[model samples]
Target: MAILPICIYGQPVLHTLAEVVTEFDKELHRLIADMHETTVAAPGVGLAAPQIGIGKRIFVWNYADQDEAPAIGVAINPELWIIPPEPGQADPEHEAEGCLSFPGERFELRRSAAAKLRAQDADGKWFEISATGWFARIMQHEYDHLNGYIYVDRLTGYAHNEAMRIKRKRNWGKPGLSWTPGIDSLEG
Candidate 1:
């Protein structure tokens, strides 16, 4: 396993739809292993294939901060169904999150309280899960990555404006940018 460089926001691959995983072989396994390593190094709860500049529908999550977290594993070509979020002002303390792509930035965005996920493993085995609380939040975040969206892209109101200001100030949201976890001072 190796730590892969994480692509930043505005990388073409992050904006482009990822291809479905058809052949579950050595390459897929290696990529998943690499992603796991990179996620751990980045110290992120999850990492998606596009974050590493790989345009494949795959992501790995390691969520251990909460009770009954999902097992750390790879989710490929996953489909997500969410319970609608209640309408209200976002609670930054409770709802704020970050992204590896938008390194060093955090924003408050409302998310579904619960979600149902159907996905496959690296070896092409199907699995289904119901995630709640922070695990569900992590799932929604990673799922958005597979669909060519960073967390900032989902922000609105003051949070959205703040994120955009930061993007402009940092000169991010452009192509040809990447960072290595455990090596770069940047954090997300």
Candidate 2:
């Protein structure tokens, strides 16, 4: 397996919505393998195709609790169904997160506590899974990339403040602060 170069935040490919994989061909499999290799090399829990300059709807993630060994797998053409937060439902707490695309820049982001997802496996077999906690957060983050969304878009309040801090550090000494308007705002 090869380690692909992850496209950074300013790369145009990252902002483009990925195309669904119509055929589970050798190339698709190879891309998944390369993505896994790259993510593992970066010591990241998840990665998406667009992050690696591929405009395909695919992602790889592994989320095993402390006790169990991590289980890594691929998702192709994934779909998500978010359960509505109940009345007075507590917002999910912020967690420090790092993207394969933005190495050495970690920030806090809040996401749903749980999510229901449907996607195909490496063999193009369909499956549905419900995830919560860290697993859920990782899945949601990677899935967002397929739809041209990044983790920074989900931050709120103090979480947004923390993200700005990290962003400034990452872009220290740069001419001007580069920001994505809608994404930079804390309001969701």
Model 2 lDDT tens row, 100-182:
65555556665677787789998899988788777777878899899887776566676667666765666532322222212
Model 2 residue 139 CA deviation in Å:
0.9
- Give lDDT for model 2: 0.72
TM-scores across all candidates? 0.95, 0.77
- The digit string of per-residue lDDT tens for model 1 on 13-83 reads 99888999999999889999899989988889899999999998999998876554456878999999997
Let me know the TM-score candidate 2 reaches against the reference structure.
0.77
RMSD of each: 1.6, 7.2
Q: Model-by-model lDDT, in order?
A: 0.89, 0.72
